[model samples]
Target: MAKPERHPRKTIPAASGPTNSAEEAKDGKDAGYNAGMAVFSYIIGGIIVWSLIGWGLDYLWGTRWIVLLGALLGAAGGFYLSHMHGLTRQGSSSGGSAADRGPSQDGAQ
Candidate 1:
């Protein structure tokens, strides 16, 4: 048996499409791409730095457990930093773009 094609339940009319939606979507896509790259870099960088530190400490102290601990700590710190510095900021910026700002009070002057 052949299957039928599926389509979206709702449709937007071409004549009434949002003015800046396309631009906003593109901006969002770019922002998301950048954020993903930054977050990945952060995680990898954190892991490598902390693991190195842990390895150094183990070497100096002749212990075998610190490297795993360091990696965990690094992962946590990376997530925290990425969230604080990138993801949250990106969300706020995307939500409050120039188009959404309407107008400024100084514009009347």
Candidate 2:
């Protein structure tokens, strides 16, 4: 009987690294959680600090409603801070404007 012909084996490329999708997802989740916590902390901290100041003012001036004003101001300041931070973040990430990007997909400029 004739000898069987031999073929060279194919070589598979090695993976770059052992990266896991679950780990990536977890990291994304953690980052989101951290951001949310930071915003919450900012708001809460603003409220607490301003409320204390207001309370002190109320005591010093013998008024009753300054604490409420302080709380409102704190809330507004917190929202403004968060909005600014969000704008900054968007600017950094987007790196472009609507004009730079093309027109709307719906044909509305």
lDDT of 1 by residue, 32-99 (tens): 89888888888888999999999999999999999988998888888889988856363554367876
lDDT of 1: 0.83
Looking at model 1, residue 40 earns an lDDT score of 85
Off by over 4 Å in 1: 1-24, 86-109
Give the alpha-carbon lDDT of every model: 0.83, 0.81
Off by over 4 Å in 2: 1-18, 87-109
Residue-by-residue lDDT tens digits, candidate 2, 37-97:
7778778888999999999999999999999999988888887787777722443345588
Tell me how far candidate 2 lies from the true structure as C-alpha RMSD in angstroms. Answer: 12.8
User: Looking at model 2, which ten-residue stretch has the lowest summed lDDT?
Assistant: 86-95
Clashes of each: 0, 0
> How high is each candidate's TM-score?
0.58, 0.62
User: Where does candidate 1 have its weakest 10-residue lDDT segment?
Assistant: 86-95
